[model samples]
Target: MKETPIIAAGLHDTRSLAQRIRGQALRMVTRAKASHIGSALSIADIVAVLYGRALRVSPAAPRHPERDRFILSKGHACVAIYAALAETGFIDGSLLETYGADGSMLMAHISHKVPGAEFSTGALGHGLPFGTGKAMAAKLRGESWRTVVLTSDGEWGEGSNWEAALFAAHHGLDNLVCIIDYNKLQSLKSVDETLRLEPLHSKFEAFGWAVREVDGHDHEALTKLLEGSPWEAGKPMMLIAHTIKGKGVSFMENKVEWHYRNPTPELLDAALAEIEGACGNA
Candidate 1:
């Protein structure tokens, strides 16, 4: 499939970009017989908006010191990040064909070995801490680059994230922005059943971070809030992005089984057709 076009200043049509991300991610997961397509789909729009418009990154310079850092804390959904990197020209899109296969740099989890990937993260609760440290480093250097961490809501159960939250707040790392994929589902069931994270917004606010919530699938809404980060001067930003697991497919949406199931060939075909139709109309 031909990739979407990115214009000057890294600005692109985010809606189209999002559609492509969804479609590409679906294809990747299916081709690789991988799990977490649900997880990947949920954050497709958020990742699309970041790479297409919000992030200050360049295909020509994947490790540009001044480039904005984007960490996928929920690294199990590596297909989404891989699709984004390929679409944005950070890696040869062809390499995505090797995902989940032996000898491939693209593993089941997000890896820093990938050109645009900053940190390898499969273990939950690690990305946020690394991101906080990156933000602090930039602050000490008086650099303007920002760190954006996209975390799964279920990872909140890990106490380490709370500690990182407190640290970011105490130091006033305003450049640190964490967007939670509050899809309300985890491995076997809903987050409420697994571990309650209600009043999640209030919890972040109490941690001394500026907090906001938005529909994660809404490309325009995500772009508006993400492009205008650090809404407060002295506080880090936490965006609660309400999302649907398996967002683009009818059978998979809100279905827990998809967390570990790859789509059948028929389901893959149907899903791709649906995504293509949606993007064509959009």
Candidate 2:
């Protein structure tokens, strides 16, 4: 097994981390004959940044009360999150080899049963409320911990999400932060064609939360956004992270067909090559 690097080395740029994890996730899914490659790729950078630099977790003590919480609302992309957890030393990296396999802890959806996962999530529009409840609990206990939820753009169509949005705003849960992976592509078609969520930033703002839009792939922007609180004193924060589906993969980018395709060996090799090149350049 490769040794985990020191967190302070400053060698692990979020983009490189995302690329590395995405490569691992690709291998995991391909070997398992699983799907959701595009969805996993879409949020890789954000997950990389969160687990690599922002999250407060202990690999040895994942249930530490003071630790920050991360809920993957877009749980179909658990491959990316699992890869991030492995890279961060929260789980044995080799365990990723069994991803999606029968009897494997690494399922296709997020599971709190995993060492680093804070909540079990897969159903769309469920994470916000769950994260809100956690944030509220922290506030009640006067803890400094924060709750962050990574949501999919397509999840905006769910009424449950809007209900949670309104509830979070009403309570002014400042410790809660929501990051939307705005890749603009859903399972069967483009988000615009399936259900237009245009003017997404405005929608969040109108709901009484603070809003910021940024390039989801840009690590620096993501780092800054994660570090700072943007919502009003009593409001929850929302970040509309503009991203590309199947980002960093040449043939998969913006191609909806890749959304559910298990990567063939040839495609996996090509994807790894691209990630290797990016890591080398970085």
Candidate 3:
């Protein structure tokens, strides 16, 4: 337990938490001259919902055996995870300032050494495979805690994930839930331009998984679907979350270049104002 009070009074809502996350990630990335702010922003709401009220985790004891495991397979966007952890009391809010600094636990990519991260991942295709193994292990041990893997839509192009998909279905790891951040933009270009993943829902269904699509930004819709989906027995769940590349910021929205661009000081000011305005609207 960090013992430091982090959550603001009257800030228990997931939407508010998400706004804080975007602001925090933008600052950390800009200070560190780091990339992936766009990647982090795209999934802020998803991660916010998870950390805000969905994940069964404890800040006081992060490794609690019964806690649900969350793996951010799209690790380049770890700024979102770090922010969520801090916002949820999993780590000292001040430690966020150390992000990407020398000797900082908050690496540019996800690090298990961080207080709440279950698995360290940066390579695109590794998160789902590892999470699948964890789900299988839990099943073998007859544990109830589920494993949720958040992956980039681009990673679906990886042959390894398909193999893992087959493995999970064969073993009936219904405890596994995979959320794809279908932002439609990869590192260099649009996903369609880099490697197409169209007909994505059918592909997962063919792999023997139950599938659903959701507006990745609609907090209510995401909460409903994420909280109640796996709608069947004998199969894993795959959620395709359609999202904009850089959500929340005016100029960055849907822009691929933001994938590798760090926010300038001026841009940071503008982005924070935009997010704050959104918070006011909410």
Per-residue accuracy of model 1 over 1-282 as CA lDDT, tens digit each: 754333223778877777778877887888888899999999999999999989988888787777899999999988888988998889998998899899999999999999989999999999999999999999999998899999999999999999999999999999999999999999988999999999898999999999999999988888888885589998999999999999988889999999989988899889988888877887
Candidate 3 residue pairs in clash (backbone atoms < 3 Å): none
Local distance difference test values of all predictions, in order: 0.90, 0.86, 0.88
Clashes per prediction? 0, 1, 0
Task: Compose the digit string of candidate 3's lDDT tens values, residues 61-167.
Answer: 68877778899999999999999989888899999999999999999999999998999989889998999999999999998888899999888888999999999
Worst lDDT run of 10 residues, candidate 1, spans: 1-10
Clash count (model 3, backbone only): 0
Model 2 worst lDDT run, 10 consecutive residues = 3-12
Q: After TM-score superposition, what is the CA distance of residue 64 in candidate 3 from its true location, in Å?
A: 1.0
Top-down lDDT ranking: 1, 3, 2
Quantify how close model 2 is to the true structure by its C-alpha RMSD in Å. 3.8
Query: What RMSD, rounded to one decimal, does every model reach?
Result: 4.0, 3.8, 3.5
Error of 1 at 77 (Å): 0.8
